[model samples]
Target: MSRIYRHPTQPTVELPPVDLLTLLFDSEHSLAQDDTILHQEAANPSNTVNKRQLRDLVERIAHGLRTNYGIGAQGPNKDVVTVISYGQMLVSAAFFGVIAAGGVYSAASPSSTVAEPARQVKIGNSRLLICGKEHQAVTTRAAEECGLPLSSVLLLESSPEWKLRSLEGGIDVVSSSRLSWQTITDRQALKDSLITILWSSGTTGLPKGVMLSHENLVAETYITALSGRQWAAKEIEKGNELPAVQYRTLGHLPISHIAGLFGYLLAPMYSGGSVVWMRKYNWEDMLKCLKQYEITAFYTVPSIFLRISKSPEVTDHFKHLVGASTGAAPMDGKLQMAANAKLGSGQDAMIGQTWGLSETTGAITMMPKGESDTTGSISPILPSVELRMVDDDFNDVESGQEGELLVRSPLVTNGYYNNPQATKDAFHDGWFCTGDIGSLRDGKFYIVDRKKELLKYKGLQVAPAEIENVLFTHPQIKEAAVVGVPAPDDPGTDWPRAYVVPVGPDAVSEDDVKAWVADRLAPYKQLRGGVMFVDGELPKNAIGKFLRRELRDRAKREMGIKAKL
Candidate 1:
C-alpha cells in the first residue's frame, strides 16, 4: 500500500485560474495595504516596497523587456532572463516582470564564480543578464564568456565609468506608452508555461537546471499558504502576543537559493505575508530586524537556530513569533525546543523542521507546528503528496526499516532541464527518487542518512565534486578528495575536509590549501575540517575511483581534534 501523510489543517481550497505573476498582483485590497517588500539599509532597515508598487514595477519591466530586448513581449517561445543580484525590490521586479511578459527567469547567486553563472546562462539559454552594480564586473565577464551581448546586460543601478544602466528606469520608459498586461485568465496556458529554471547542485558533477512550470510553483504556493494560515489559527488558539497571528516573515536567505526563493520569499508573499529581505546576512543586523519588524515567522536552518537558542538578546527580541521552521540540515530537537521556549513557546509558539530537495520544489515533508520533539519526524507527506520508503532494489521497506524516500506530488518537478538520462534514471512509476534514506514510522517520516554522496555543511549543500574541481585548479595538487565529516564542536553540522596529494617538493601547506579554497569557493564550502597531505595514491577500488569514505574516516582520526572554525 502507498503511504500518504496528509496535513491535518491544510485545506483543499479552489486554486486560482491564473499564473504566479497574476496571483501576486491580484491580491485583496486589505492585504495589499501594507508594504510587501522590506530590506535592510543599516541598523534600521526601513526600505520597503508596497504591493501596488511591485505590480507597477513588474508591468514596467515586462514592457521594457518586450520593447527593448524583444523578450517575453508577445511570443509563443519565451526568452530566458538571468538575474544575478541580491534580494531586493529590483530583483523581485526583474524576476516577476520576465514571467509577466512570458519569459523564463533564472536567478544566479552573486557569490558563485564565473563557471556557475556561465553554465546557468548557457544551459538555460538566457538572452539578457540583469546584474547588480557591485557584481557588474563578474557579471560582465560571465556574459562575455557565455557569448551573451554586453548590450543586453542591465545593471541594477547607474554607474559612471561602466555607464550606469537602470533596469527599472529603462523598462519604465519603454513601457510608458503601453498598458501593463492584465492578469492571464487562461488557466491551461498558465499551467503549461515554463516560468523558472531553478538549478540544483546534482549528486555529482556540475549543477543541473530544474525547469518548473507555473502550475508546479502555484501548487506549492497554494499548499504552503494553507499551512501558514492553519499555523496562524493555531497561534491564535494558543494566545499570541500580537492578538492574532500576523504573517510578517524575514527573508535573509539568498534569493537565488531554492530555500530562500520559495520557502522565504515567494511562498510568504503568496500567503499574504510581508518579507523583510536583508541585502546580506549579518548576525547582529538580523537580530535587530527580527525585533524591529516584530516578525511573526522565520524560515531558516538549524545552525542559525542553534546560535539564536544561545543568545539572550535574540531570544528576548522574538517573543511574538508564531514559529521557526528549519531545514537544509539536521536539527537537534532539544536545541529547537530550547529556542522555541526562549521565543515564548511557553505561550504556544511553534518550532519545526522539514526534509526536501530542489527536485521536489522545496520541502515535501514538514514537522507539525507546536511540536517540541523534532526527532527528524517531518510530520506528514502534505496534501496530494505521497511518500514511499524503498530499498536499493526499489522494493518497499517494512515498518521502521530504512530506505530511500520516493516522492510524488503536483509540486514535483517535470525533470532536469537538459538531462533526459538523469531524469529517466531518477524516476519510477510517477515517483521522483529522493536519495535521502529514512523510515516511515507511524505516519511521520524520520530521516537517517542520504544514499547520495552530496554533503551538507551547516545546512548548505556542498558537493565533493565541486570542491575537488576547485582543488584541481591548484598547481601543487596532484590528486584531491573531499568529504564531509562531523564538525568537532557543532553537534549536527558537517564540515568539508580535503585530502590532497602533492605534486612537487615545494607543494602548499595545509593552511595554504585551505586559504586557496576559501578564496575560490564560498565561505561555507571552505575546508574547515582541515586538509591532510596524504602520501601515495588515495584510497580507490578496482575501478580506480577515489574512495571518499576512506578519506572521511581518516579525517575523523586526524583532524577531529581541531576546534570549531
Candidate 2:
C-alpha cells in the first residue's frame, strides 16, 4: 500500500490519487487556512520583490493598454503579448499587464522560431501582438499570416526595421499605438480575464495551447507559496538553520516552460526569495554563478546535472550550493547519486525531484527533503494534487502496476484552446490523460516508459516524427528513424539519435546531414547524438508503423549502448 500522508488536504496520498487540487486546495476550508500561510509570504518583510511594486507595475500597464490604445474593460481590446522572461521581474509585470487589461499573455520560448509566434495569437483570437522590437518583425509576419492585422502589432522596443520608411515610404497597415513598457506596467487590475497560452512541447504531436485563467494562475501560485514553507521547515529540521540566511535560486529555464515560469519564478518571488538569471544553459557559467552568488537553490533539467558531474570544478563549488531540484526530464539513478554525494549532507543541500507538466503550472509532486535514494521516483504527490492510474481500457490500475497516469485538479488546464476535439480526447470525465506510463512503489511514483515515442533532452520535449520529417527533407535520405539514446554526459536524459538509410551508396556524410538539419532547427533539436547508417529498411512491427522499441533495442545491440535506469 502507498503511504497515507498526514496533511489535512492530503490524506490518501496514494499513486495517482494525489493531484494538484488535492495537494493544495481540496476544500474551501483548506484554502482558507492555507490563505493565511500564503498571505504571510506576501507580507514577509524580507521580500526582495515588493507587492506594491508589482501592483503598481500591473496598474500602470493596464492604464497604458487602455489609454494609449483605447482599450477599455468592455471594449474589443483583446490583444495577446508574447515574451520570454529569463527569471527577470519583466515576466511578472507582463503577466500582470495582460490581466489588468483583460488581455491574454501567451508564452513563447526564446528558442522558438520567428514564424511560430502566430500559434499563440491565433489560438487566443488576439487582435494585437506585443513583443520586443527585435522580435517584432517575426511576430508581425506570423500575425499577418494568421489574419491578425499588422496595425495591431506593437513593438516594445523600436528598430530601424519598424520604421515605415524602410518598407518604401508609407506602411501598408496602421502602426499600433506606441507606449513605454515602463508606462504600461503600472495599471492596476481591470478585472479583465487572465489567460496564458502554454504550448505543449509536442512530444506527442503538434503543440496545442493550454488555456489557463487568472483564477487558475493565482490559485496555483498561492498554493505553491503556501506549501513552500515546508522547504524552510525541512531545512531547519535537517540541522542547517541560520539566523541571517536568505533564500536565493539560479533560474535558467525558459519562462515559457511551466516549471520555469511558475515553480522557479513566481513561487520563489511570492515566498520573499530572489532568483538569479542565466539567459541560457552553460555548465561553466552555472558553476561560476553558484560560486559567485552562493546560490542556495537551483532549478534545472537532468542534462545539466550530467554536465556538472563530468566537470572537475563541480566538487569545489558544490559545497556552497544549497538545495537542488531537477524536473522536466528523467534523471538516471546513478547520476542522482553522484549529484547527491557531490553535495554532502553537512552543507544542508538536498537534491530534490519535482514532477510536473505544462498543465499543472509546474510541480505535481516534490520529493521530501533529506530523503535518500529518490533516484527514479518522483516522490509523493504534492499537498493538493491528485493522480490516478488507468489501464488501457480506462479502468483503474492496481498499485505497483504500470499504467497511464491520469491527473485531475483545479491546477490542470481547463482544456486546450479552441480545440474541443482535443479537449474531449485529452480528458476522460475530468481526468487529464498524461500519456505517460509509470508505476507506484512504496508511495512514490516512477516512470517506467512513455506510451508514446517522444524524446526528452534535459526535460524539453522533442518529437521524433518532427525530426524525422525534417531529416526526410534532405535529398540523400530515403528512410529515417529517430530514437533517443541515453546521453554519456548524463544517463538521466535522452539524446536525439537518428538512424538513416540513404538512397545511394555513400550518398551523404554524417556531418553533411547534421549541418543540413542544424540550419533548420534550434540548438536543442539538432541531431548532435550522431547518425548511424543501416543497410536495409528499418525494423517494423507487424503493422506498417515503425516499431520504436525494436529500433531502440537494435541500436542498443548494434551500438553497445547501455542505460543506467
Candidate 3:
C-alpha cells in the first residue's frame, strides 16, 4: 500500500509566491486590525513592536544593512549575517530586515557554547554578527576566531552614540519609509532567493546550516494558518472566546529555531496575533504567564510538558489556555494523554502536534481542528507536502510498517550550506531522507525513533523511547533515557541500561527499579544490563531532546571499557 498525505485545502488553494518581507508586512496579509504583532511580557519589559512599528523597524534595519554593509548591493548574494539572541523585539525585525536587504541571516541559539557558535560563524562565513550583550564574550571570541573584526559585531541594544535606536524606542516611520530598500526583479526571483539559514540541532553530530528560501518560509506560514491543527483556531473552538480579545502566543523557546521561527513567531504574525516573549523558561514562570496573558495557544517541548502535566498547577493555572502543543521532541501516548486531558475539554481543546525537520521548514504534519490522535501518532501530512516511508533500499514500505521518512515539496530545504557532499547524501531521487523512523495508518504518522539511534539487544531492535515511556509511568522517576551498552564480557552482544533522574532527594534502589520493570516487560526487555542514576538533569540539546549518544558514552566510561557507541 502507498501512503501519501495531502492537505484538505491543497486542491483549491495555493501559497502566495513572494518574498518573506512582502508576506509579513504587506497590507494584504496583515491579520491585525489594530496593527499589533508583538506582546512583551514583564520578563522582557523593554520590548514591544506592533505591526506598523515592526515594519518601520525592519525597513530601517534593511536600509542600514544596504547603506553601511552593502549586503544586497550585488543582488541576492549569499552574504551571511549571523543573529544570536533570545526573542527580542528587534530580533524579528533583524530577521526580516536581513532578507529585505537581500542578505540572509543564520539563526544561532544563545545557548551555544564558544565552540558551537564559532563553528557556525566559520561554516556560515558570516561577514557580520548581530548579537546580544549576554553572549558578548563568546560571540566576540568566535568572531575573532573566524577572523572577523570586532566592529563586525552588532548588538541588539540601542546605541545613541551610533545613531541607532533599540526597537524599544521604535524607529522613525518617515525616515525608515524614505529609504529605497532593494527589491527582487520578479516573484520568481523572490521565490528562489535565500532568506534565512537555521542550524540543525546536532544530536548525532555537528549542526549543519539548513538554507531556506523566501518561498519555503512563505509556504510554511500560509499552511500553518490554513491548517486545522493550528492551536489558535482550536482554542476559540473550545469556548475561550472573549470580547475583542486578540489571539496571543506565549513563546519561551529561542526564536532562532525553526519551531520558534514558524510555529511561535511567523505563523502568529501572519495570523495577526501578538506573541508574548519569555527570555527563559521555568515551570513556575510559565504558570504565571498563562494567567497574566490569558495566553490562548502554547507550543513547547515534551520535557516541559512532562514536568507541568505531572504538576498540581496545570489544571488550575492553564484554565485560560485554549490549546497546548509539544514540539522539539516526541511525546509518548501516556504523557500525551495526560497533557491533553489537562489542557483539553470535551472532544476538543487540545491542539497542535505534528512533525518537521529543518529541511521541511517547521511543521509538515498537523492534526486537523476537528480531530484527535493517539499518543505517538501525529496528524496527517500537510496538503502542500508529499511524503513516503521507505525501507533500507528505498523501496516503499507497507503503510502500517516502519521505515525511514522521505519528504518532497516546496517545504523541503535546498540543502546544507557550503556542503555539497552532505547535500547529495541527504537526498534520493527527488525526496529528502528525514533520518526518522515512522509508519502511517489512516493518514496519521507515528515517529518510532531515529534510524541511527535504534539499539540492538539480543538480535532485536529496541527503541529507547519505548523503555523511557514506561519509565515515565513510574511516579518516582522524573526523567529517563535508555541506551544499549556492550555486554562487559562480550563485545559482540549488547544489553539495555537505563539512566534516570529521580524526582526528589528520596533514594530509589536499583534492584527495586529493575523489579518494577521485570514484571511489566519480557525477560529480554528487562533492565538486565542494570540501571544508573544521575544526580542532575540528563544532557540535552537546546530544545530539550535527550542527547542519548552522550549517555551511551558515559555508560562506557563508568564500566571502565571502551564500549562502542
Candidate 4:
C-alpha cells in the first residue's frame, strides 16, 4: 500500500490554468508596473529595467525573434533557442523573449566548452544560439560545429547599451517591433507547453534535458509564494512586528540551472522585487553587494553558506538579509546554525534548507518563514506536493523509516526532452522517483542518502559518466570509473574523482590525467578530488558491472568521512 505524505500544516490550493509569461506580467498576480524588477549590482543607474520596461522588451525581442529568425513560426515548443551567457540583467530579456516568441528556452552554462554547447544544440535541435559578449567566441564555435548558421547566433549585450543582434549582422532586436505572447488558459495546453529545458544527470548516464512546462513553473511559483504569504499573515495576526523582507537578491549563480532560473528570473517578478545582476560570481564582490544593495532575501547553495560561516570577511554584510535559503546539496546542521547567527540583525533569520532537483523545477520542500529547524531536516513537504518513501519492491516503508523518496506534484517536470526511455524510467506509476533516500518524522523531511550518483559541485550538476567518457578517450586509460568524493573544505559539495586502470603500468601520471580532463570538460567537471590509479581491475559484480558503492565508500574513507556509503 502507498503511504503518501502530504504537508500536515499547509493546505493545498487549486492552481489556475495559465501560462508562465501571462501569469507574471498580465495576470492579477503580476507585479506593480512601475517598480524595478531587474537591477545591476555594479550600481549603474542605466542598467536597471522596471516591470513596465521589461514587458515591453519581452514583446520587442519576441517580435524580433519571430520576424528575423522565424522562431515560433510553426507554433510554440517547436523552436528551441539555446542561451549560454554570463549573469546579467538582459539575460532575463532573452529568456522571456524566447518563450514569448513561442520558442523553448534552453540554457547552457557559460563555463561550458565548445563540445558541450555543441552537444546541447544537437540534442535540443536548436534553431538559434544566444550568448553574452564574453562567451561569443565559444558560442560561435559551438554554433559552427553544430551546423547552425552564424546569422542564427544572436549576441545579447548589456554594457554600453542593451542590444540583441546577430554575430553575422543579419538580425537585430528593435524596440518598435512588438509581439504579444498568447495567454494560455487551457489546462491541457498549459500542462503540455514546454517553456524551458534545464539539464540534469539522473541516476546514471550523460546529462539529459529536463523538460519543464507552463504548468510546472506556475505551480511551483504559486505554491512557494503562497507558503511565504501564509507565514507572514500568521506573524501579523500574532501582533509580532515582521521585518520587511523586500525580495532583493544577487544573481551570482548560473541562470542555466533551475535554482537560478526560478529564484532570479521568476520569483522576483512575482514578488514585486529586484534581482541585482552580478556578471559573474566573485566572493569579495558578492559580500560588498549584499551590504551595498541592502539585499533582503536570497537563495544559494551550502558551499556559499560554508564560506559565510568560516570567512572572516563576512561581518555585517548579511545584516539586511531577512530571508535566506540554501539548496542543490545537503547542508551541515552546525554550519546552518552558525550562518544563521550572522543574518537578520539579531532577529529570526534562519538559513532554511530546501530539497529538490532540476526535475522538480527547483524546490519541493521549503522551510516556511519565521520557522527554524536545526536538525538538518529539509523542512516539511511543500503544499500540494505528495511524497512517498518506498523500498526497492515499490512497497511503502514504515512511518519514519528511510526509503527512496518519490514525489507527485504539479511542479514536477513532464520528462526529459527527446528521450522517451529516460522519461519512462523517471516515473513509477504517477509518481516521479526523486532518487533520494529520506524519512518523514514529525512532519519534517530529512535526506539520509542519495540513490543517484550525480555529483554536485557548487550547486552545478556534474555527471560522472560524462567525465568517465572523457577519460575513456585517453589511450593510456584502460578501465575508468568516476565517483563523487566530498570536498574537504566545502560542505554540501563534491569533487569528481576518477579511479583508473592504466593500459600499461606508469603510462600516465595523475597530473597528465587531470590536465587531459581539464582541457576537454568544463572547469566544474574537472577532477579536483585527484585521480587514483588502481593496481588491476576495479571491484565489480558477477554481471561485470562496476561496484560504485564500494569505490564510493573507499573514497569517503580516504577523505576521513566516517559515514557509511
Candidate 5:
C-alpha cells in the first residue's frame, strides 16, 4: 500500500478546463487586463505592453503565421515553430502568437551551438525558425542544416519597434490582420492539446523534449499562486496592513527553461504583475535593474543568491524586495540565511526554496509567505499535488525515510514528445516518477539526493551521457566517463568533469578534450570541471558497467581537497 501525502493546510481548488489563452485573456481569472504587464528595462520611457496591446499583437502574429506561413492550415499542434532568443519583452508575443495560430512553441537556448538547435529543429520537425537579431548567425546555420529555406526563417526584432519579418523581406507580421485562438472547454481536448515543448535532460541519456499541455500550465499557475492569494485575503479580513509591494520582477533567466517560461510568460499575467526584461544576464546590470524597477518578488537560482551573499555591490538593490525564492540547484542553509538578510529593510522577508523539475512544469513545492525555513528543506507540497515515497521494491516508506519521490498532479507533463518508450518508462500506474530521492517530515519535504545522473550548472541541465557521447566521437579517446564536481568558486553548483582512458599516454591533452567539447556542445555543457587522464581503465562492475559512483566520490574528494589547498 502507498501512503500518499497531500497538502496539509491548503484545500484543493477546481482548475478551469479552458485553453491557455482563454484562461489568461478572456476568463474571469484574468488580472492586469488593463494594466502594464510587460516592460523593457533600461529604456528611457520603458517600452511597455498592456493587455490590449498584447492581445492585438498576438492576434496579428497569429494571422500572419496562418495566412503567410500556413502554420495552422492543417489544424492545431501539428506545426512546430522553433524560437531561439534572449530575454526581451516581445518574446512573450512570439510565444502566445505561436499558440494562437494553433502551433506548438519549441524553445531552444540562445546560447546553443549550431548543432544543438539543429538537433532540436530536426526532432520537432520544425516548420519555421525564429531568432533574435543577436542569434541570427547560429540560427541561420541551424536552419540551413535542417533544410529549412531562408524564407521560412524569421527574425524577431524588438528595438526600433516589435517586428517579425522574414530574412528575404517578403513576409512581415502586421497589425492589420488578426486571428483569435479557439476557445477550448472540452476537458479531454485541453488535457491532450500540446502547447509548448521545453527540452529537459531526464535521469539518463541525451536531452529529450517534454511536452506540456494547456491543462498542465493552468494547473501549475493556479496551484502555485493559491497560497499567496489565500494569505493576502486572510490578512485583509483581519484588517491588518499588507506589504505595500506590487508584483514586479526582473526577467534575467533564459526564456527557454521552465522557470523562465512560467515566471516571465504566464505567472505575471495572472497575478497582475510586471516583468522587466533583461536582454541577457549581467550581474551588475541585474543589480541595477532590481533597484531601478523596484522589483518586489523574483524567482532565481542558488548561484545568483550565492553572489548576493558575497558581493559588496548588493546593498540597497533589494531593499524593496518582499518575496524571493530559489530553485534548480541545492542551496546551503547558511547561504540561504545570509541571502535572506539582504532583502527588505523592515519586513520579515525570507528567501524560500522551491523544488521541482521541467516534468512538473515548474514547482510542486514552495514555501508560503510569512513562513521561513532555513534548514535546506524544500517547503510543503502545493495544493492539489499528491506525493509518495517508495523504496526500491516499489513499496511505500515511512514518513521520515528517504525514497524515490513520486508525484501525481495535473501539472506533470504528459510525457516526452515523440518518444513513446521514454514516456512509458517515466510513469508507474498514474504517478510520475520524479527521479529524486526525498523524504516527508512534519508536512515539509527534504530532497536528499538525485536518483538521476543529471547535473545542473547555473540552472541549466547538463547530461553527463550527452558529454560522454560527444567525447566518444574524438579519435584519441578510448573509454570515457563523466561526473559532476563541485565548482570551486560557485557554491551549490556542479561542473562536469571527465575521467578518460586515452588510446595512449599524452595522446590527448586536457585542453584538446575541452576544446573538442566546446566546438560541439553549448557553453553550459562544456567541461568546466576539467579533465583527468586515467592510468588503466575506468572502474567497472561484473557486467562491465562503469561505476560512476566511485568516480563521483573520487572526483569530489580529490578536487574538493585540492581547492582548499
Candidate 6:
C-alpha cells in the first residue's frame, strides 16, 4: 500500500508529461527536424540518430532482455535470478532497462560501509542479487551473511571458464557459468514492480535502500529538464531552434551514487546525449576530455569545480562549456564566484547548483543558473517535492525561523529496504525525514546542518564512518573515532577530527595521516582539524556508540584552556 501526502500548499507548477521516454524521443526528433544536431554530428546526423531508429534500438534492448533474462516468463516455480544487486555496470543497465520496461531501478550507493549492508538489504525489499564479476565476492559474502540464499544471487561477470552456461539457475551454477552484461537483455524490467532502491546518506548508522519505480525516475528527469529554463534561454539566444543542451556529461561520480548514475548517465542518455566516463579520478584527463568532447554541460561536486579553477589547463580547455551543474556537495559562495571569474568573459556558463539526497531520486531543490548568491541557496522545491520546516514540537516554523527539514515527494523512496522501525521513523505521517537541518526563506532552501553527526567540507559530503573505515585500512591503527567539530568564526560550518588508537610507536603523524586521506577523498573533506593520538578507547554511550558530543565538548574545553593560558 502506498501513502500519498497532500501538501499544506498544493503544487502550483504545471505537471510535466508522464511519458518521459516519449518526450525525450520527441525532443530528439524535433532537434533532428530543425537540423540542430550537437557539434559532433553537425555534418551528418545520419550516423548520429533518427527517432525511429532510436525507438527501434530501445525495442531491441527490450526484446533481448525478455529472451535472455527470462522476463515475462513462467518458470518451474524455481526463484529466477536477476543481477540488479551487485556489479555497478549491471545495476546501471538494470536501471535503464527497468525504465524502458516501465519498472524503477533502485538507487544504491556502492560506497556504503560494511556495517550498512544488512540495513540496505532490508530497506530495498529486493530478493534478487545481480552483480558483475569484480564485486561478486563482496556481494555474495554480504547477501549470505544477511541470509539471502545462493539461488537469489545472479552473477554477470565474464569469465572464460563459464561462457556456455545459462544464467537462470542457482548461485553456484551461475557463478560457474559466468554471465556477462552483454548477454543480458536491456528492456526486460517489470514496469509496475519496484525498480530502484534509493538509500539515505547513512552518515549515522546503516544505509536504508529506498524503493523507486520506473515512473519515478522518468518523472523526475522530465521535471529536471523543464525546471532548468535558463539553459533553454541560452539555446534560444544562440539562434538554435530548440535548446542546444547536449548530453555530454562527466561520469566520475560512482555508479552507485545518484548524481553519478541518474544525473550524469540516465538523464543525458535518455535525451540522446552521450557521457564521458572515468574509472578513477584524474583531474587533468577530465579537463582534456571536456575540451576533446566539447562537453556543453558539466555535472559534478563543487570540489571538482574548485580543483578545475585551480588548474590552468582546465580553464584553458573547457572555456567552451556553456552550462555547468553542481550537486552532491554544497558549493561555497567564494568558490562559485572564483569559478565564474576563471571561466572568463566570452562564454557565460549557466552555473547552477542543487540540493538533494539519494532517496529523492536525485535533486529536490536546484539553484537555477543566473541566480545571484546561489552558493548555499538550494532553490525552490520541485513540482513533486514538498518541504516543511518544524521546530522541537514538530510544529511548522515561521517564515524566517530555522527547523528540521521534512520532505515529501513522489520521488521519495517506498521505505528503507527491510528495517520497518527505521522506515517508520524515516517516514512519519506523510513526510520523509531528510535528517538535514535547513531553513526556507522566500521559497529558497538553505541547509543548516545534518541531524546525524556527519561532516561536510566543500561539496563532497564526508561520512564519519567512511573516514573511520579508512582509518582501519591503515596497518598501524587499531581503534578510530571520527567526528565533526564546528569550525569557529569560519565560513563553512564544520571541520572533521579523528581520534585514533595506534598499535605501534612509529605510527603515521597527523600531517601524514591527513595527507593520506587527502589522496583518497575530495578536497573539502581533508582532515584539517588535525589528528590526535589517543592512549585508550574513545568515550562511548551505553550501547557502545562513540560519544562524538563528548569529543566536541572536549575540543571546546581545550580551546578555552589555551585561550586562558
Which lDDT tens digits does candidate 1 get at residues 1-565? 6554355555244566666765656644124444655322333355556666667767777777777778865663358888787655456666677777778888787566788788888888888888887778888888889987777788863211212254333433225534365466576776666778777643245667777877777777776655555766777788974345667877676777678778554766665667776666767888888888788888776546655765556656777687677766544445556556667545543777777877787877665543445444665656667777887788888888777889887778888776898789879988899787776676556765556666777676666756775676566776677888887677867788888888766578998899888898898888887787878657742112465767766776665454443
Q: Against the true structure, what is each candidate's TM-score?
A: 0.74, 0.66, 0.90, 0.80, 0.81, 0.64
Q: What TM-score does candidate 5 reach?
A: 0.81
Question: Model 1's lDDT to the true fold?
Answer: 0.68
Best by lDDT: 5
Over 1-565, each residue of candidate 3 has an lDDT whose tens digit, in order, gives 5555566556334767666766666647647544574656446544566777766767777787776666777877488888787655556777777777778889898788888778888887788787776777888888888898766777775221112332223432113442434544366765566778999988888889999987788888877667543455666788865346467878777777888888655888777787777766666777888778778877888877777766766765666666567666667787787666677352453745778888899788876665666556767677778888899999889878889999888889889999999899999998999999988766567888888888777677777777787787778888888888887666656687999888776667788678778867777777867898888889987777889889988987877753443
Model 2: lDDT to the true structure: 0.59
- Order candidates by lDDT, high to low: 5, 4, 3, 1, 2, 6
- Candidate 4 wrong stretches, greater than 4 Å: 41-46, 201-204, 235-242, 346-349, 453-565
- Give candidate 5 misplaced runs (Cα > 4 Å): 43-45, 201-204, 346-349, 453-565
Residue 240 in model 4: lDDT: 88
Clash number for every model? 1, 32, 2, 0, 0, 28
lDDT of 5 by residue, 1-565 (tens): 6788888765466898888999888888867666565555455335778888888899999999998888888998789999999888888899999999999999897667899889999999998999999989999999999998888889997777789999876789654789999999999898898999998732245678999999999988888888888888999999999877779999888898898999999998888888888888878889988998888987887656755765667889988787889987555465677678778772454788998988999899899877888876788888888989998777999988778899898889999878898899989998999888777777668876566776879886676756775676566776677899987678867899999888788999999999999998999999998999998778742213356778988997897688799
* Candidate-wise lDDT, in order: 0.68, 0.59, 0.74, 0.82, 0.83, 0.55
Cα-based RMSD of the predictions, in order?
10.6, 12.7, 4.1, 10.9, 10.8, 10.8
- Please give, for residues 259-297, the per-residue lDDT of candidate 6 as tens digits: 766754456645556555544445666666667767666
Where in model 3 is the C-alpha error above 4 Å? 1-5, 8-13, 44-47, 158-188, 228-245, 344-351, 489-492, 561-565
- In candidate 5 the C-alpha lDDT for residue 452 amounts to 71
Candidates 3 and 5, the one with greater lDDT: 5
The TM-score of predicted model 3 comes to 0.90
Q: Candidate 6 regions off by >4 Å?
A: 1-10, 13-92, 98-108, 112-127, 140-193, 229-245, 310-313, 343-350, 369-375, 441-443, 454-565
Give the runs in model 2 whose Cα sits over 4 Å from its true position.
Answer: 1-9, 12-51, 70-72, 75-79, 84-88, 147-151, 156-194, 225-243, 344-349, 369-372, 454-565
